[model samples]
Target chain A: MPFKAINILLLPLLLLGVMVGVWSYIALKIPGFPTPSEVWSELFVVLSDPLYNNGAGDQGIALQLGNSLARVFGGFAIAIAVGVPVGLLIGMSKSAYTAFNPYIQILKPVSPLAWLPLALFVFKEVNTTAIFVIFITSIWPIIINTALGVRSVSEDYLNVARVLQLTPFEKVFQIILPVAVPFIFTGMRLSLGIAWLVIVAAEMLTGGVGIGFWIWDEYNNLNYAHIIIGIILIGVIGYILDTVMGLIADFFDYRKRGRV
Target chain B: MSLKTFLKIDHVDKVFPLGGGKEYVALRDVELEIRENEIVSIIGHSGCGKSTILNLIAGLDTISKGTILLENKHILSPGPERAVVFQNHSLLPWLTVYQNIEMAVKKVLGSTLSASEIRDHVMKYISMVNLDHAKDKYPGEISGGMKQRVGIARALSIQPKVLLMDEPFGALDSLTRANLQDHLMRIQMQTGNTVIIITHDVDEAVLLSDRVIMMTNGPEATIGEILDVNLPRPRKRLELQHNEEYLRCREAIIEFLYSKFAKDDE
Candidate 1:
């Protein structure tokens, strides 16, 4: 094989091998750490019957993953349903932007964990608190990005709408929505990533039937191998969710597709 | 050739507020009367408020002083009656050529026409601009000339009373500009719609207009002269190249622009 092509093909595997070597060395040095093989074996055991039901507290990996995804999607949908219209209003009117910008600026930088106490106090239920955390974490990116998108719409397009004498509703649906699609999808993609991240953290705190809770439970039991497995699964799921959103963003990006 | 005044711009002035209690006068005492089916071209150097005039007539910009009336009614705001073909051929990049034309047609005539009628109306203008094969292509996929053709098609599809063009072919190359100018002439001849074109090209102003309204330089630009283009209709581009009347009209506009209101830098 040519040197460059071989470098491209072998570099990632080489890196992975080095990582595994380092991990194994760390396991040998540490008393309670799981080795690569131990985690691999535990992953197989967990994957063997992922949907296995063992009552409320001891569900299989697949069911836990399902629970995490359900909470993330539920909170993310509600965030979208509220964020987009509020973003449009803020973006369209200068007054609304001025009125709301202070709150957005103050609230946006706050960590989702910071909201957990307040959410738990208000919601009381563990499930609602977890979902609230996801909602609060994800909503800011969506609102800000959507507003930016709407604001960045070319004046030429709006001039076209005005000259055409399109009704206000028609202007929104036909012109603004179409032009803002890429921006909206961009916001959604960011929010989805944040939602996935926040859901795991929230579930860990709330103690639910999710992957985060499963990891916590494994830690309490001193099953370091299962903890390693759970960490890998979370990373993989987060990567898959981001990739799916990227695909959707590409599909709707008229500028990239050159259809617009 | 006196005819009924189809549109009137009476002593119109435009002042843009620059904040801090200061203002900029873009145009002042700009008066004009456009007869029915008349093709008028406004020509000037850059920053001369020629486009400001077109925008005022199209109701895209509000007049600071005086009134603009079309068909004996005040032109208050932008409406379907004055369809503007913008300088950059602002075709919605996301929409196909057919869809772009169909959008204007559906918006203007959807209430009065059947679905098939609307489709036919859109297709007629699309074919009028000789863009039948390109109807399915997006604006990004087409050449500049083709995009301009679609812009014209979209504007004409509405069957507007006055077709307002703001340097419509300014972005195209010379050959493409000539091609669109000819296409515009042919379409105007067929449709008999009143047109007001803003141009920097002297030949274009002479070739396309019945009267070329020349403007002075800006900050307070006003009509310096109006050259009557008495060149006959159904004029051929190749034939008119050596024609005396065409040369005369072209020369008059050139003299007015270069000699009468020549820029300080020139």
Candidate 2:
């Protein structure tokens, strides 16, 4: 067990060392690209007063990240509110599923960025358009996964509900929701991931006060080290979001409880 | 002693659609009359439609061509009056043992009984199944036998007129199966609840039932023979090992399943 624990720490550190070696080589070749030490110094500077606001475009890294998060969450919350009920409606009835499935299939694979121009024209505002793009990117998984969760409810559980003569409302709350919650969380997790992924690109296109926009602004100003720092920050924050989502999903999952 | 006919199944047929203008007949001309407070076991090989019969009675499945009446009331849809103990011990995995039983109690008796009465009612059945220690434990935490005990407890807690158990102990190991069988017998004796159990186990049928209803193999299955298990109640597994009636009942089921209507593929 102790050996396994050592390997867990050692193996990743070994990979990181190899990656930095490759990165440093690339930086030397590229001339303007930041080396590992340069990016490390920039990270310290960026982390040092993350919430400073020096007008709209010159906000601190934390403020930029906070704005991106606000837009992503705004879109994500709306997607959940709309997606869950629609998914449940489609899940419980064959007619509803038949009506909606074709459109879902057609629309799901279309890129969220593809909708940006239309959203920009419709909303006539940058933040609204960014949030709208995040919504588009995040909604498909929520609807599809939530529906999958409802369909995955066992016949045995439904039989118990029927035998008890549970009212439709009681059945949905006491039986269906409990069974579907884990699935809904799975959807939400996926939705949040896509939402985060799209927010960066959306902010870049919209010229907004967000992490994506800041990264682009740094690139334009030729402060290449800050771009690398931004990449690391985004990666770390996305990892944290995914980890938190996973923990929440496990909490609601009945299969995870008491069985290892 | 003459007993009142509590539940009746008349001329039932179950046919499944085979997609392309064809159908598969699962059961045909299925008939049964279960007495009040009596325990009946429907035993057969796999695909014998014993479960279909139970499903029909429980009103979980619609009858193709027949009527099922519990106390002369037509069984149209599933209700709290006919609670089922499923083969998989279908206790809601999310709810604890107490809460699982409590959900049924609250739903069935919620209007008639107050909150305190409901709590007492749930506790009564949980104790009846001897799962007091595991009351707060979730279904996934307990052993298979204990889960089935909770399943039985939940079914009984609803105060159903007929308890329908579809292969309730089939999933458990033999030792656990025996333990649960003993638990079931004790509970049934105390409550005097009418139970119709679907089983493929010949020994289980003879041991737990007042009458073992043997079913023929399907493509149109029906009750083949009804063997009377006249062995006295509070039947201990050890004592029944050498009892004449017990052996006779076991032999009849084996003979019916193996000799008269055995499945060639099996």
Candidate 3:
């Protein structure tokens, strides 16, 4: 019943929805589950409203969404660009791997939220604070994945390159890069997911116009329905972002004989 | 210039230094002269440095003593002039059959052919190895036999004067091994290229070589003897096996090895 071979998950989901509806009805006789209709209508108003309504300072939902994307992308791009090359260097040399791995290990466990106060104190800009959180949150996965990817290259490939008298640049570009691509893409996907997750939490801690602050403000206004709606939106968007990255990673990993 | 010596291995010796002061003598005072278009097969037990000699010829490793001159020139490093087909084939796993062949061909023959011409040139050698059907497949998608074919095709595509094979068929199954042996002989006879194959199988050496060089076991290893195989050309499998000349040469090599080593019962 939990897993239908026919992908009949909709049956269980529908049953769960009905159970929630029946439970809401029973709760209506008592107190506060904010009927399903309340949640939906609240989501509808927030999505369609021409004004911010929640004092996001005149920026609508669409504008806030775009701003959030720009901040996340800027930080995520920096993480990938810096992390992959450093990882490749570490992967190729035992000395470098030994020296750098411990530093990364030490830094990796420190949460993005832990960086929040320092970021606020030093950066002094809301966007920069969010960006720092994202950059720190996403970098380790990319670096670790890239290093693992580079280390996985076969000795046969190395021997062939050696026999062919491949220049170091040519060897790295033609042989090393193509073989390491799957690992790099895997790292990128992980970093992108982490960046998206971190930004939401960062937004909540540092009051801004992002979806996180919107949800927190809704709770402050005693509008629990809008808060639930914001949570659903955040979950849905995060899922979509992860799915897109996953598809891209799969495409690169399986593709044969492509450019270096 | 007579074809008496295309390569001269003058008193070559390789000593591998194991850590903590232990030293292993891999080869000692080894001398060899390979002629043009001659198929010289070397047979030996494991740890005899048969592969060490091949790597030295390819300049993949430095000799601790002695010199190897290819076409009367000193070898400094691996170049396109002497192409090698290794035992494991060492095909780049990411490339298709066509692209793997194209790699060496592209580097050596780049100025000689245009872009489309290089494609045709690569395809010609792939089909020469009977791998036209597996053109777009990666090495991992192919069998062990097919992967070795790709290695042969890659080496041949560069059109090197000497083709150095190091126990290439040793890793293959018996049936595929036999099939490849036939394929190799047919190609060698057709091209008339000089080749040096290293193997341990008595029959394989007898079947493939113009001369078989039997090597002694190491402490300080050296060539035991060289036996010329005078079996007729365009060799027939069933006929050659039964021929007196072939049997006489085969028995001579077997007897010589047994007498030299531990064939006391014979």
Candidate 4:
């Protein structure tokens, strides 16, 4: 990074550190307030434990985390497979757009949690319902972004495509897909966040082996420390997933097309 | 059977159905013939559908009441035979300059050409538009003029028979427009492809065309006059900007436009 930009960036971080330091000092003054050391100890146990750390009852932390990842990744991947093509189809043809957008509009506002009861009854399996929740939440962003990208393809590009006698398949691949990448990535990033959110909610309802169920179970057990651990873990995991997505998005956004 | 009359547009009319069940005529009774190696320009006020005529020839849009013929064949769909360079430089933002042209070649000439051949063709065309150094840069990274060059390169790479340009330089600043006009005229001469350009700029119409077809404004648009540019070939901007014929043609167009158009007619 340039010195100027780096300095500009550091200014905020320094301010944040000072603010956090002051907050921590003020927090320590309060009676019955748990210090950072206490939080750290609680966090350590969850991070290192083989059992009962932040698991879904008897299930281990590693196993539950793995299960959550699987459901999230699985549902997210499926959403991309279904959402992007559908988005493109929705974005491209006039008739397709007319039909598809209404359905998307209806689905967009309906919370993924609302679908939990249906998913539980229809799926009759804990893991499937959890995956279904992720699917419901993640699919919208991918579809909406893909549609926006495809729809927003420049008129000049279309003219060039038409004049060049580009096959519809070639037009989609060569013209539409590339133009739509930024939008697709935006959707994917959104979908990943949604996947995490919906999966957690679904886990609570389905009572399955994931972080969400573990968090709820800790509350039932009256272990506030374990509950805090579960909450911190959720935030940490969510941040990491979002950061990774942002990096991927930035990579494509900065990557240029042909000369000029 | 002469190559001169490679493209013929006959009695074209376009009408748009407006609000309240009425209609607006965008173009009416338009007829034109462009030769294999000539540059024909259409000039008019805004909304006269000069671009519409070019669109009809390019087959981007259908003419409501007449047919457009290219190479003695009726134009029903867009083909590689005629390439259009639009006013906006429509470089796909995701693709680099090289890929934009390569896409044209790859899509149109894919079955006939290999990868190396496609690269060679695109590279040659990109360089032809003086964009060789920027071939790897995407559209967002480039200047607007450079993007338009990519548009031109993509069009020319196909070796199109007739080039349809709709105010290709209208979006450009004066300096870039003049520079590209020189490049375009030279390219047109070298390739000997017939070109029909639509523009509202009188100087541009006078500078680039062999003959200027003047279009009048309207709710119902039609040609006001056709003025032959008798100015000598390979014009210098500074010289021609002050030439007598150039001034005469400009004056005639201005008079026709102000007298006939510039009105609020229902």
Candidate 5:
């Protein structure tokens, strides 16, 4: 084989070896930290009976993961429903953007963790509070990116709309939305990542059946192996979510036509 | 030719604001009258505001002074009656060539025609521009010349009262440009639509236009000369190369651009 092809095949293996070596060194130094073998065994035992249910508050890893996923998707769907239209309006109208921009700017930077206390106080329910945090955390990128996308629609396309005498509704549906799809998808991709990040943190605070809570429970029991498994699970799930989002974005991407 | 004026530009001036309470004058006292079924080409050097004049007529830009009248009515904003073939061939990249034309046809004629009728109408224009084979192809998949053909088809599908072309073939290679020019001549002959083309090519102005409106160099550009091309219709590109009248018309435009209004750098 050529040197370049051999390098490509070997590079990933080398990186994996370095990661395992560093992890093993940390496990040895920290004393309580689970080693790679310990975590692998725990992962296998956990996977063998994933959907087991001892009772309420004590369930399998699958149940915790399902709960977390449900909250994330619910919050994400609501955010998209509200954010996209609001963004379209803000982008299409200069006066609306000017009027609403200050409020968006002020509210956007507040952390989702910061909203958790207020949400818990108001909703008084762990599940609703967790979902609220996800909603608030994921909404800003969608709205801001969508607004920017709508605003950046090419003048050439809008000129075509104007020349065609397209109605305001037609302008949005036909030209603005289609042209802005890629940018909106970019925003959605960012928002989904944020949603996943926020859900784990929110679930940890709310003391619920979620991956975040699972990690906290494992930590409380001093089961270091399970904690390591939870971390790996969260990482894998987040990767899967991002990959799915990317595939959907690629499917709708008009700009990548000839290049793809 | 009939004497009735279909479109009139009277004493028009365009001033673009350059911030800090200053403005740049692009066009001044640009007056012209276009008759029904006439092909008028506006040719000038860069920055001569030939495009400004075309935009004013298309109602794509606002005139600082004077008025543009189409069929004795003020042209205030762009409407379906005036369709433009943009310089870069602005085919929506997401839409296929067929959908691009279908969009224009559906918007203007959808209320009058059934779905099948609309499809047939769009296909007629697609074939007229010789893009039937590539109708299903997206703009990104097509060549520059084919994209321009889609632009032309999209513009004509609307059945506009006047078709406006802004350097439609300027971005293509010489060969593709010549091919499109021939296609345009044939299309114009078949439809008899009033056309106002903006171009920098002298031969393009002579071969396609009934009258070429030559603009002087800018700071404030106005029509410098109007040369009438008395060549017969259905003119062939091969035959026009040897035709004395075509050569004389082409030379007149060349002399105007190089000698009368040549830039200091050129």
Candidate 6:
């Protein structure tokens, strides 16, 4: 067990070393490929004054992250508000599922960015358009997962509800919701991840003050090192988001409580 | 004994639609009249439709023909008057044992009782099953036997007219099963509640019931024979192990299941 544990810590570090070594060799060969050391220094430069605000188009890293987060959250919240009820209705009713299933199947496979042109044309504002894209992309997972969660409720639990003569409202709140919560949270987590992924691309396309736009802007100025820094930041943030979401999902999941 | 007909399952039939205009007859012309405070068990082979009978009585399933009546009131859909303890002890995993019982108590007795009164009612049932120590624990935290006990407590807490259990202890180990059987017997003695249990175990049927309704094999299973267990109350398992009446009842059920309508597949 100790040897296995040691390998867990050692393996990632070994891989990271190899990656840096390859990058340094490539940087030396090419003129400006931004070696690991260059990105490391660029990270410090970016982090030094992350909250600074110069203007609308020019802001610090933290402010850019904050703007992106606000949009993702805004779109994410709307998705939950709309998706959960729709999911429940479809899940509980045969007729509703029959009606909604075809549209969901058709719309789910379409890329979030595919809606970019239409959204941009209708909204006219870059921020609204970006948020709209996030909303559309994120909502599918929420609806699908919530419906799956609702469908996953055991017949035994529903029988218990019926035998107890629970009102329709009571059945939903006491039986259905409690059973479906873990699934709903799972959906939310997936939706948030999708929303985060979409927000970056949406910002890049729409031209705004976001991490995605910041990376694109750096590319325009030929700041290759800064782009690498932006990529690292996005990866780290996404990892953190997923971790936090997972923890929250586990918290709501009854199966995780104490099943031996 | 009053000999009052507390629950009547008269000429009931359950036909399940198997699509393509085909149907499966699970139960046919099943008739039973349970006395008030009588402990009746329906014993059968795996596919004898014993559970289907229990479901019909609990009003959890529709009767394709005939009717089920409780105290002369026609039973249609599931109601609090008939509570079922499922084989898997289907306690909501999210809630603690105390909370699980409380949810049922609150739902059924909420209109009649205050919040504090509801707490007392829930705690009372929790103690009846001797699970007060583990009441605060969630269903997932408990052992299988303990979960079944909680299932019993939840069913009884509602003060149903008839308590229906579908192979309630069939999932537990032998020792755990014995323990729950003892618990159920003790609870039944205290409350004198009318109970109908569905089980495959021969000894369980004889030991627990005043009447054992032996069901025939399926493809349209019906009551093959009904053996009367006239053994005296407060029947101890150890004592009943050697009792002549207990041996007779157990043998009668075993004969019906294994000799007459033995299911080869299961």
**Which candidate number maximizes DockQ?**
6
In model 1, the Cα lDDT at residue A109 comes to 94
**lDDT by residue (tens digit), candidate 3, A29-113:** 8566567788877778878863555555446666566666777888888988898889889988999999998899999998888
TM-score of chain B of each: 0.97, 0.98, 0.94, 0.93, 0.98, 0.98
User: Candidate 2 clashing pairs?
Assistant: none
The residue-level lDDT of candidate 2 at A190 comes to 93
Query: Least lDDT summed over 10 consecutive residues: which range in candidate 4 chain A?
Result: A251-260
Best by TM-score: 1
Screening candidate 6 with a backbone cut-off below 3 angstroms (N, C-alpha, C), the clashing residue pairs are none
When 1 and 5 are scored with TM-score, the better candidate is 1
Model 5 DockQ class: medium
Answer with 1 or 3, whichever has the higher TM-score.
Answer: 1
The sequence of per-residue lDDT tens digits that candidate 3 reaches over residues B1-266 is: 14678988999998999999999998999999999988889887776688888888877778889899988898768777778899999887767888888887887887799999999999888988899899998887889999998899898888888888999999999889988888889888787788899998888888888899888877687888889998767776678778887888788777766666533332
Query: What is candidate 4's lDDT per residue for B128-197, written digit by digit as tens?
Result: 8888899988888888888888888888888888888889999889999988999898787677777889
Q: What DockQ do the predictions score, one after another?
A: 0.70, 0.73, 0.32, 0.53, 0.70, 0.79
State how far residue B249 of model 6 sits from its true place (Å).
2.2
**lDDT of candidate 2 over A14-103, digit per residue (tens):** 999999999999998998889999999888999999999989899999999999999999999999999999999899999999999999
Clashing pairs in 3: none
Order of candidates by TM-score, top first?
Answer: 1, 6, 5, 2, 4, 3
A-chain TM-score, model 4? 0.84
Give candidate 4's error at residue B103 in angstroms: 1.2
Reference contacts reproduced by model 6? 0.97
* Candidate 1 clash pair list: A260-B93, A260-B94
Choose 3 or 5, whichever is better by TM-score. 5
Q: Tens digit of lDDT per residue, candidate 6, span B104-157?
A: 998889899998999899999999999989988988788999999999999999
- The 10-residue segment with the lowest total lDDT in model 2 chain A: A251-260
The parts of candidate 6 lying over 4 Å away from their true place are: A4-11
Fnat per candidate: 0.78, 0.89, 0.41, 0.81, 0.73, 0.97
